[model samples]
Target chain A: MSLLEVKNLCVSFSAKGKEFAVLDNVELSVEQGSIMGIAGVSGAGKTTLLRTLNLLQRPASGKIAFDGVDIMSVSQEELRVLRRRIGVIFQSYNLFRNKTVARNIAFPVIIEGVNKKKALEKAREIAEELELIHRLGSYPSQLSGGEQQRVSIARALITNPRMILLDEPTSALDPFLTSRILRLVKRVNSVHGVTVIIVTHDMSVIKRVCDQIAYLEKGKMVFCGPTHDYFSEYYLSVSHDDHAAEQLEKAKKILAENGGNKLVRLVFWGEAAGEPILWKCSKGLDVSVNILYGEIEEFKHGPFGTLLVATCGKDSAEFLRRLSGNVYKMEVLT
Target chain B: MISELTRATLESLYMIFASGLLSILLGMPLGIILYTCAGSKRLASVYRVMDVSVNIFRSVPFIILILLLIPVTRRVTGTIIGPNAAIFNLTVAAVPFFGRLTENALNTLPRGVSDSAQAMGVTYRQFVFMVLVPETLPDHILNASVLLINLVTYTAIAGAVGAGGLGQLAINYGYYRFQWNVVLYSVIILVLISQGIQLLGTSLSRMLRK
Candidate 1:
């Protein structure tokens, strides 16, 4: 069953007497016990979508159902109850500067009127799990960025929330810290059964921890599907580097100059990603293949990649036809 | 001479303590209200009125403020001469000053602190007492210390107007009778009190900082 569902959501902001839409008719659904990543460029409304999920930013119009309840029409008391079930971690960590780490982690439960001693004990247990037990007494200022991020994760997990929304959780960390935090997120999902909806610009983050991916552009969800499919179908559009496009252009130029019959782009995923389809096709069909560019990325499901190549031979058409049958996708760039 | 000096010192202390307590009790809430009001769209007009009032009060000189408040002081204390009446004036003067200090202190708090509190679904009461108050307490203490020192000087000025304290002793003996010794002693005592308050405030804020 879907843990959360959004339909026809619209959010807008008025600035200087002009109303501008920040999110326009966006739709999404997150399955129970699954990890989904939301990716977009700056000002693409990625953060706004995340905030709207928790009702931090109310939409102008839409329906959001959480755990089979339409949250948009819920009473204030019911809304509060829904909020308790969904934890949110911000980009800046936002630990209370005056509170000790222990107090910061235990703050949610403490406000719920839980016994202070019991809350702190539960906080300690979470801190230990997140490897922050030693810094329990220290203030947030004393910890490094990675440790602060861990503390934030610990606080989010301590509430035993059925779902957690992380807004650019690893945007401020280095690569090593990013991977460590991602590993912790995966563990939280697997061990605690918490549904995760993380908004990030980093593809590696999506590849590492997310089972599904959603791409937002200009406040609209452009693509949403399984992780490998995003890598296969829409990876180039989201990748900031224009290397693949450049390579495709270069391959076209070479094909034009060298009189090659066709320049082709191929995508591989799952079992096809492991097979040497290009080499087998060339040797089997007596065609000469020139690999212009290739990149393979590891996703949660498996390896997915894109390749651009130039082909020239008597049986090049047969080689192309044979290669198309084995690959996930084939595009002719002649 | 020693007994007179002691009496004047005690009187000054009484004025400072009473006015300081009253100003903080009134002022801290004013500060919190101002801070809260500024963030609210519905309270924009209320914030404007309170902001203008605070600025107007803070702009007037303290000595002139005492003179202007004589009628109000008389109504409150039934007399315009003595430490009690002086305290009434001092509190009136200090509340706005402390309230502005509080607003500035709360302003220095990061926006995320409140955002996180709201995300946790805290009640409005818990957000104020648990998050807002404690987050800014150290700044409050430091501002209060500064307020206390200002109150001490105000107390002395009030004494010059028949509120019996060190200021009256210095003026009557040292200024009129040319007994420079009394002025010297009073200056030393006032300096000591200011220094003591500053020291206490610094350490208390430091202890509460983390």
Candidate 2:
């Protein structure tokens, strides 16, 4: 089940007497245990969308459901409680100048009404995990940017939030620090099953950590799919290449019995999907097959994607003519 | 000569301490007000009123302020010509000067500091008292020291109008009687007093700075 579902979200801002729509009718979802990355250029409304998730900016109109509960329907106190379950880290590492590193981490815990000592202990625990145990007493000015961001991550993690929204958490860091932060985030997701949502202009960040990616352009979601397949040419992949010649001869023989027609591959998901479609197509047509590259992908559910090819003879053409109405070409590997 | 110097030194210290305290107590808040209101687009009208009043007060020289306040001083404290009366006039002049100084110091702060505090869920009041004020403390102290130096000169003028302190002593024995040695000694002591206040202010600000 989806842990968070945002439908048709819209956000706009009026600054200096001009209205700009930052996010327009954007939709997104996160499954129970998946990291989703929202990748966009600056001012593509990635930050605005992340802010809207926690009600930092109320949507002009939309439904945001966290664990199947409508977020906008909750009372102010209840919303605060809900927000506690969704931690947010900022790009600028907004650590309080007057507060020490420890105090900055302890802020959200204190907001949740945890006693000072208990909150400090929890903060210390996370601080140790982030490798900032010794620098807790130092003010923000004394620490490097990477150290400050680590504290910010530690602070977000201390809440044990069900979902964490990271807004360009590594944008200010150098390469070394970026890797360290990415590792920390990966570790957080792997060990704790925390649902992570990151808004980043950095493609490397998207590639390194996200399981699924949603690409936003001009405040609209242009692409939303699994990480590997979204940008890949994967419509044609076939396994069992050793038997490729054998399958091709058999499929060709079957297609020769029928008149010339169209031949198409109806790509289906999972192991159960491709076999039946292929069998049904063969029984219904005289199949002259050109078995291309076919492969099976093991998705979150089960094996998915089947690549096949056929050359329709006369009767197969008639059958192919009927079947061409519904199918997508994965690729022309030949 | 030593005894004479000692007595005059005590009197100078008294004038500095008493008038300095009065100016700061009244002046600091006025300074905060001037800062919060002046040049802030949110409080443009308040800035205008404050601007006009501060200009009027600042335009009047210290000597004239002391002279003008004589009757008002008599009305308030029932005396127009003593060290106490001198303090009243000194505060009147010092507050506007110090307030403007304070406003300028606060204005020089990076706008990001306040904006960042607001984003942290800090209330507007806490932003002012905790972040804004503390961040500007070093500059505020520096300006206050400058005011203290100016007040030393003003205090001597206060002596010309019967507000007796070292200034009265200088004028009566040295300037009036042509005892240039006495005037020279008084001038030397006043310079020392200002120098001491400046050194203290600088060290204290250094300690407070990051």
Which prediction has the highest lDDT against the true structure? 1
Consecutive 10-residue window with the lowest summed lDDT within model 2 chain A:
A325-334
Query: Which runs of model 1 end up more than 4 angstroms from their true locations?
Result: A235-241, A257-259, A279-290, A312-319
- Minimal lDDT window, size 10, model 1 chain B: B115-124
Residues B181-209, model 1: lDDT tens digits: 99999999999999999999999999999
Off by over 4 Å in 2: A1-38, A43-88, A94-99, A103-123, A155-165, A186-197, A211-334, B1-4, B31-44, B100-116
Task: For residues A44-137, write the lDDT of model 2, one tens digit per residue.
Answer: 8888888888787778899999999899999866776777787677877766665678987887777556799999998899898889999989
lDDT at position A119, candidate 1: 99
Interface RMSD of 2: 4.5
Clashing pairs in 1: none
Task: State residue A4's C-alpha deviation in candidate 1, in Å.
Answer: 2.4
